[model samples]
Target: MARRKGNNRKKTFGARDDRNNGEWTEIKKDNEKWETYYKAQKFIPEKDWDFFKKTCQTQLPLTFRITGNRKHANEILDIFKTKHLPQLGNVEFEGEIIKPPVNLPWYPDNLAWQLDVSKTVIRKNEQFSKTQRFLVLETSAGNISRQEAVSMIPPLLLDVEPHHKVLDTCAAPGSKTAQLIESLHSTSDEPTGFVIANDADARRSHMLVHQLKRLNSPNLLVVNHDAQFFPRIQIENNGKKSFVLFDRILCDVPCSGDGTMRKNINVWKDWNTQGGLGLHTVQYNILTRGLKLLKKGGRLVYSTCSLNPVENEAVVAQALRQWGDKIKLVDCSDRLPGLIREKGVSDWLVYDRNMDLKTKENRGDIKESCFPPTKEEAENFHLDRCIRVYQHFQNTGGFFIAVFEKNGETQKDAVVDEPPKEEPNSAIVKKMKTDSGDVVVTKKEKLPRDANEEPFIFIPSVHPELEKCWKFYGVDDKFDKNNCLVRNATGDPTRVVYTVSKSLKNIIESNEDRMKFIYAGVKLFVAQRSDIECPWRVQSESIPIMKHHMNSARVVECTEDALKVLLTHAFPTFDDFKDESLVSKLKELKTGCIFVSIKRNDPLKEDLFLPVWNGSKCANLMVAKDDTHELLYRIFGIETTRNEQKKPQQQDEKKEEGKMTENKI
Candidate 1:
């Protein structure tokens, strides 16, 4: 299981030690850096430090095993240490190392200390797989945050068979995706299943990619598009399209993120009544969409990180309202006995009959629950189906989840794809033709060979407002081409086709200018833009573009010289011209290369230094070079036996290979 340290009011588990303590040591090697951070407050006196130090030693790797019968607790603990402990030398209890079990049955034939427990965890004597174990310890910023939402997923889902198709809607910064991969052992086994992780915002899908790389999960296909409008894609591989309907889907929708209060005080500080309401609609939309793709008897889990009633119960209640008896809310309260011990409030504002707190809270600042209901009455409604796990319960982060099954027939009509809209060639033509005055152009001659020779168009520099629109729309396709093609529509040259091309060129150059931005920092959203004139404008046509482009646009790091080669050779496939006419045009134009600038001091990177109350670390580090690796080892208190530092060029390559690449940083 991921380990935990002690807690302090000032030192919330997720608090950044480096940010909180500025004199924090900064150790830089290659492209990566390392620094120490401390959470937990200074509440303990000097004398208590001795005791706390002892606790830290013993509690460092504490795995909280909640047993069905208290009598088995001691026996289980004894067996764990005696039989299993010796073989798993890397595993620890608190901080001290123990020997392998001398007195146990069914010992390792080839055991690897994996922690794959049965679904009935509390009831049996569980064995730890060679893989690491995990627990839902507590909910607070110091322990976990919104970005790590998927970490709360039960490892039991990993029990899924090979070849199964899994869907993770609202999957970004995919911690759960990583977990599923680890369980499936994607690297060694040729599993039959594939994981389709989708999010509404195209940009945020970058998180899933980053985590996938770090977690080294290859069975996943990342899609940067709206999950609600997911294409019913057919995968005809070896002999057939292995999957049509998904066996499992996780709808971890967006919410106010109340569970993140411990890490992000800003949310709680700015909390408003409408906070939950604003996100509930989108959450409902994504969930309903997933339900459509589920096969008969398929299981789906709807979950959220927010504690607010509007986001949690209200959305689920609305879902039940919309589907009638087509779906049944299965009881998942029994899944985590460690978590269920905590009480959850079922008398949410939605159930209030007379003094409806929801209405009162929104209409005005109402203090009391106008429509009060008895505890027994609330219990009868199975409000308990909505699990409310808090941080205090297990020193883990807070999160809520409910499982359901599709019981009856799905929509009889072949699930129809959203109708296609007509293409608007006029708009596309106008945008390329309009003249953009005073547009910034790069004068760097003999530019990096890998850089695109195509006349660059930087969108942000050409028009600040257009750049603002980029964030809203995400990619180049989202622009209103109809407006672009109608040169006279805007009268302004800068808003025309010529200007649009210039804008595109400028964006390419700027990306080159900001070389550091080559890698995505954090994905905030995902979106797509379509051609106005393509005949294949159906959902199928759109899916390929979104999938291929999403994969292609991703930044891959190589040696500086190699990157320069790739950048200088970039070109554009301007849709303005047909392929017959475009053949000669391609030879004359050059490929485009843009530099992405990353902040010198990125907040997300800084956030990693925050103390992890209960955290997991991969032993074989992905570092840039031997020196950088040495530096990290030193911080972790590992002694270095050699002193040979590699050359800068070699170090750079190693750094590219070995460092921890964050989703946002």
Candidate 2:
């Protein structure tokens, strides 16, 4: 191959194929940008020619175009032509030409989504036909292959059918988010459930959205906000509709990413002890914030790609100290048994003097602690609940996971939180007679499933070919059946029945217009009152009780049978409603239902987030004229404006500089 010159983009070239001997050479004209070659040769590969051609072109063109000038490009081409053409055949560059592998790793044994084309030219290969088909296969413990990870999801997810609200904090390039979505959809069908995926950085947020879009999951919502400030997004789970308190939250916080060192050599360069420590505060804040977002008895899983103590154990310890009994550490050894589990207590690295003393006494080893002895030793000790996934297990990169359970009554019977305050027209009257002959109002526990023990019928539409799969279960409807209970006309629109409790029956009849439920049966109905203005909410304390009790009872069709059983049960505490209302008010305040108007001046003005009152003097935060102040107030609702504050000395200097005559006048 010889180098040609001129305007590469404007050059008009045509291929000259050889019928007998395949070879290709550039066709050049004197006036054109490129040089011409005589008698180009065609290259042939040992493998199937069609497959080889497709493989070369599918993921190569983007990297090849605009590589460099004609000479440089030809030089690169000559290398590939001489090296690969003889065996692979002269692959055409006209339509989607695949670039030749350059100086890259040739590790064919390791299976990945990409091919080992070159050191820097990693690419997605199109050779495998089962690229998108999901399958399930069992492998040795902790030795699951990539193909297995990709295929084993559907069945397990169907079994896990996670219906509760889930949050993926630090989600970017959302691989796990996609998995979560798939699991949610495959699980028992439930209407009105949602997943919130959030990321802090603006650029990565776009990537998160992009990855999620490919999954086509209707349940996911992407949010762009700092995890530390997520509490500001008020969620209402009013009795009528529950606001989202995450049932499951994944805090995959940012860390030093030591596990990624093989791909990102940059991580190993200039890595320091302080680098991991620097992220400790942010990681801790994110986990704590996630804890707040959890409903009572909700589960949270915190993971990191770093192996350092400051970034892992230290952060978890900080959370445990602050939350204490409110959050309990959950062992996840069963989920990842193949990977070695560094006993959380044994492997936990304590940096502070107080904690190090305990670790040393317990382990009788000083050198192994991540925080060995240093001037900062006193600062790093108190952490206890962090686990490390080491490279010692299954040749995989380091990963740390900690599952926390938010249980017990506000940390106290450890009873649940109160329910929302009743609306003026709510049927939950101040007082009502219980079946036990007490005039105690407010339902305590959840009502029974239905009026009778008839199994609740659900019809789900299946693919025509899969119709046989539904016959055994007696599925009458398809997607048309209500997967979730709703309070609507007749209360059994979806054919699901509900059973009302003795105390609740009066409330239900009192506000029949506002009452709603999923009558899975006569004695049981998923009851909710819709008259409330806010979203439905559930208190943290009530979550455990709800999960435990709900898990035991099976759904029934008749409402009467459910009521018979529910009437015998005591209502939940009066506090559940009180807690619900308190949380509802908090949500209202957070969602900005009450608007705060601000003034703005320059159109380009940034940092206008302050919420201030109308006509009030703005906070003296900026330097501007009355017009600017008014504009600030109008634009941001900040209480203070530039007009209310004196100009700073730096502004005075700039003003003086502006006044100086350009020409010596």
Candidate 3:
């Protein structure tokens, strides 16, 4: 495709997609300004420039990760290795070898995987359907996350602990946010630390709720706010109100996205210096606010998908120059061991939209901070500590990551950090940039507040419904009664009773009126028939939590075959189960909710806990239809039980995934 001449916002371009016999559209693979701008920086080796561009034009491989609890992730991994990998190995269709999915070496424990095939081939070919079904179902079940390979890097380096309060300033379409939540619950059923996933867009923040819903994390709280001016939240500290600071913060700010050209091909036509230059101030401000809200000695990562120096190194240089050594780029070269990356460029030139070197005369909207730092300034900053992931290095998208530690890690209890002294909702004083490029501390202006959130009403511990579930489900003293709450204006638990982490409970109770609460908690119970003694049914998402609380009396032993029949048939008669003892146990139980414990096996691997509804003569599987379909296919080698004719496969696949939460890990 040739560049269009004249008048495209002062210029024009040609990336005409010419087609022949429905063959791949031949999009021109080159852009002049994009090439010239990066060539001047010399970030890549001269010998690899052509190779880098070549790789950028190529399609990005499909990548995903097995998500949820550590042990659950292992179970999924075992199935993938034993079942999927062998079948996918060197698969062929019409004389072409479909490369098998490979484990991402740098990602821990081979949980992350990459497949080198086009979406067209995967969806259209009959040979890959089983694998595709497996991916689709598990993804629907929330046991798997189909995330980009490079997109998984920042959270890994964040090194979040179960007790650290973490924040994602720009979380949206939240794959990375999902990883952070998994890390928080890695070893414990209930993590002390909670996650705050905030996006500037209101709609995107709600969309985040859907993506993160798979994890069923009671610890996550989604909020919609401009990241650059995210409000300072207050939490009850020793019975006194105080501002809360985060221990781990991710600043994956908005960028030019040129590095995504391998998949987002429009960058070929849209690439320009203005894109990198235009968003610099906003990006810098977001990072600065993230730092301000980070606890001392806490970790905060600043990253962008673009490889532009103005957006990457120049921003880092400016921050380092402002804070001096107070905040330093953390050396992460030893982490993510197999990850290929380059050192941050210490020197680079800026450019204007006209493809000319940006200077005082023509650098409109370009901040002075966009300029390369002096040699002395660069030396002090030690900019080499930043990590740059190139497209050619590991067949991944371009990324720039700079991890920072404020002052140095504040020590807490194997517990959480005590935030520095600050006032709640009291005009947060932070750094800002003047139009002329001078830095000054100023009181932030009032941001738009939200009054639309439903109240999170905690149910009383001694309520009749609570007492009934306590007796019937065997919920013990170990479970905190205060964690159970409902969302509505009337403060009534008319339907679902959800569970939240103690940390989130604190934030919500302290700041409910001031903050925007999009979604939180795992479904502990849903309204059931009043005819039963226990008027609440256990949610599949809450099984992990309920597992520890329920005693042996509430469990019924089941096998893979029994589970298969129960899942596929929806409701199976008591006599349908082969085990006489299982039937006797169900017969003994009240006609309400029950637990079926699948003992450790070769295929299922670990003990699996499932919720069920016991009737007088039959037992109904509590799992959702989509989740049931996934289990049948992935565990029993059976395709969907419901006929494909009933609904279009695309429509079926596109509907919301089952209620699998990240807690499966």
Per-candidate Cα lDDT values, in order, are 0.39, 0.38, 0.79
- lDDT against true structure, model 2: 0.38
Q: Report the lDDT tens digits of candidate 1 across residue range 1-665.
A: 11233445354432445444444432211110000000121223455544433332221122222221122223333334554465555434445443332221111111112232233331232233321221221111111112232244533432444556677777777766544544444223334465666666655766566656433233455554566666554434445433257778888887777566544444434545456556767777777877788877778878887656666665666566567678877776555333333333454443221323354446444322222234554544455565665444333345767676888755551175742422322211223221355543223221232232222222223443333333322345533222121112233323222222222222222333221111111111111112111111111111212222222221122222221222221111222123433224333322211111122132322111100000011111112233232222322223222343322232333244232222101
For residues 330-382, write the lDDT of model 2, one tens digit per residue.
Answer: 65445533334464432333433222233555644322323333334323432
Q: lDDT per residue, candidate 3, 503-581, as tens digits?
A: 8888877765466678888998887777667777778888877788787487888887788767755356776788888
TM match of model 3 to true structure: 0.85
C-alpha lDDT of residue 449 in model 2: 27
Model 3, position 470: C-alpha lDDT score: 78
Best by TM-score: 3
True-structure RMSD for candidate 1: 20.0
Top lDDT hit: 3
Worst 10 residues of 3 by lDDT: 656-665
